[model samples]
Structure formats: structure tokens, C-alpha cells
Target: MYVFIVALLAFVLITPAHAQVHVDIGIHLPGPPQLVVVPEVRAVQYAPAAPANIFFYSGQYWAFANGGWHVSTGYNGPWIVVTPQVVPRPLLFVPVNYYRIPPG
Candidate 1:
């Protein structure tokens, strides 16, 4: 009976340490907080659509897979390609559905 009690106590103490749920998500950083569960599935959509075409999904915003940015009136883009002459800026210059009014 004594051995049984000791075994039970040891198990209770050790089991909790291993009971943790290990979830893998992102790459490991060679530093603190080594392992982390990157439940962020959004970042995975980097190369989702065609570089020149785009479509909205899930709820968050999405952009075309185009090697370069584009400008359009709506999701169905292909309009005037935003250039330095169009706006003379980065994200601000674009005019596609991706281009939203600055919140200020």
C-alpha cells in the first residue's frame, strides 16, 4: 500500500508537466519564447491568389498575387496601374479595391 501511494504521488506530480498541449505553428526564433503556437492562419495567405488577380475570403482583406501592386475600382481590378504620376506614393497611391480611404 505504501508503494502504491508513493507511485500515485509521483505520477500526479509528473503527469501535469507532460499534460501540456503542444501545438506547432511558426518557425523557431533562435531566442527567448522558443516554442509558440502560431494559431495565425492569416499569414499563410501570402501567396493565395494569382499575382494579377484577387478575391476576398474569410473576412480579412486580401490582395492579388501580382508581382507588383495594382489599382482598380473594385475587387475586379485591371484598371489604371498606379504609378508615381498617379499618386506619387506607396500604399496611398494605389486606387484598387485594395486602396482604402485613409482613416483619420
Candidate 2:
């Protein structure tokens, strides 16, 4: 019985398990800033009350950060970005009033 158990253990160690598990977690983004555009700050027309350090508003793409609306020509971009960066990081995306424009 001891010999049988030892042999079984040896066989398990030597042979590769048929039931194998492998996992890959990844989201492939195109390499950094392939096409980089410096955006401009148009107006602080929304909820931030003050413009952001980075912002742009265009027909297709829109990114608001800092104090500007970065408008990209397309979804991926050839962005005409912009900003009015008085402060940093204080401006973040708000879910409740995303499209609500702030009054001066």
C-alpha cells in the first residue's frame, strides 16, 4: 500500500495535469499619446463654476479636466485640447451634474 501511494504521488508530480487553468487580465490601449494635441480653455460654462486645468469640447470627443474642454475631432482623436489651469486635481468628474453648466 505504501509503495502504491508513493508511485501514485510520483506519477502525479511527473505528469502534467490535463485540467490546467490560466488567466489573463488586460485591456490593450494604444501606446501613449501617439498623436498629442495641446488643447485650449474655451469657457467655464458648466458645473465646475471655474474652468479646469484641462478641458475641451468638440463635436465628437469631450474631455474636461483642469479648466478647459478638450475637443477631439474624432472618438480616438486629433484633439484640439484646451484648459484654464488655475488649480490642480480639485476638478473631477461629477456623475449627478455631468452636463449641467454652471453660472458665472
Candidate 3:
């Protein structure tokens, strides 16, 4: 009984916990902004006139705001924060000048 309890406690202590956090970035766009294809990276398009650094690639909208990356299905977003790894490679390769609000 004692050995089983120790083994159970060890298992509990060694286990990892995973959690999902939902974040709202508060991005409001009046209408879809015109997207210009990135010259260097053809697959990625950017909104040169947007108030925020916005990109479109692979049928999803990506924005750089509030010191992180956010994504949505439409240009005007109920944005959700995502890790840097999940951002598409083409979008990530966009030139720094293309970003309306460049990251610090």
C-alpha cells in the first residue's frame, strides 16, 4: 500500500498540465482593407493602409498588435492571440517596412 502511494505521488508530481488561454485583442476595422501582395514573398499579402500591421495568407488574417501576433478569418477581427510558431512562414518573412505598426 505504501509503495503504491509513493508511486502515485511520483506520477502526479511528474505529470505536466496543459492550459488554453483565450484573449481578445480588441481590433475593430470599419471595412476590409486592400491587401497588397508582398513583392519578396508572393504568398503573403499586407494591408499597407491599415492602422495595424495586418497580413493575409493561407485564407486567414494575421495581425501584429499589443506586442503579440493575432489571427482571424476576416479582415475585421475578433482576434485571438497565437504563439509565434503558428504564424505562416510566408507571413513571417514579410519585410519590416511592410508593417504599419512595426514591433519594437
Candidate 4:
């Protein structure tokens, strides 16, 4: 009984943080983008399988998800929304098919 209560309390406490990890910009992408190693970041993926995947560039991480764009300083994000015009052009040009994850 004690263990169950502790587990429940832990879940309740952690749920909000877990939820924040995946932000929804209001648009749902059909799928994630392809992983590419762009030069801007040490090794960044252009697109991700999860619509809200993060890409590292310079000293920040960029996210293209839910029809909007956001940027953060770390992989786990407290993302700030940006307009389409602000998004990197190369990311916009990534082929549509790159979002898919290949079958094993």
C-alpha cells in the first residue's frame, strides 16, 4: 500500500514535466522528419519522426512542429514560438519523405 501511494505520488509529480517535453504548436504533422547531420549544429537531424523533434544549431535547438516553429537552448525544451519567416530555409526544403522512419 505504501509503495502504491508513493508510485502514484511520483507519477503525479512527474506527469507535468513529461507533458512539457512534448509541446503542441496546434498543427499536427503527418509524421516526423528525416534525420540529417547538418553543419550548423554539432550533429543535428533535419527532421524527426516525432513531429516535435529537436534540432541543434549554433547553441540552441530548433523545433518544427504542429504547424509552427520554436527554439530552445536544450534538448528538453521550454520552447518559444516563432513565425514561419523565422524558420531556417534549409529545414523548410527538407524533402517530405524524409519524415518517415524506415522499416526494420
Per-residue lDDT for 49 in model 4?
48
Best by TM-score: 3
The regions of model 4 sitting more than 4 angstroms off are: 1-44, 47-51, 100-104
Can you write out model 3's per-residue Cα lDDT over 1-104, one digit (the tens) per residue?
99999999999888776434556666667899899999999999998888888899999999998999988888876677888998888887898999997789
Candidate with more favorable, higher lDDT: 2 or 4:
4
Candidate 4 lDDT (Cα, 0 to 1): 0.57
Backbone collision count in every prediction? 3, 23, 0, 8
Q: Which consecutive 10 residues in model 4 have the weakest lDDT in total? A: 95-104
- Compare the candidates by lDDT and give the number of the best one: 3
In candidate 4, how many Å is residue 63 off? 1.4
lDDT of 1: 0.33
Residue-wise C-alpha lDDT for candidate 1, range 20-71, written one tens digit per residue: 3322222122322112111243222222222222323232222333333333
Error at 100, model 4, angstroms: 5.8
| Model 3 lDDT at residue 49 | 84
lDDT of 2 at 70: 50
Which is the better candidate, 2 or 4, if ranked by TM-score? 4
What is the total number of backbone clashes in candidate 4?
Answer: 8
**What order do candidates take by lDDT, descending?**
3, 4, 2, 1
Candidate 4 local lDDT, 30-51, one digit each (tens): 4433446754443446544454
- TM-score per prediction, in order, is 0.21, 0.24, 0.76, 0.46
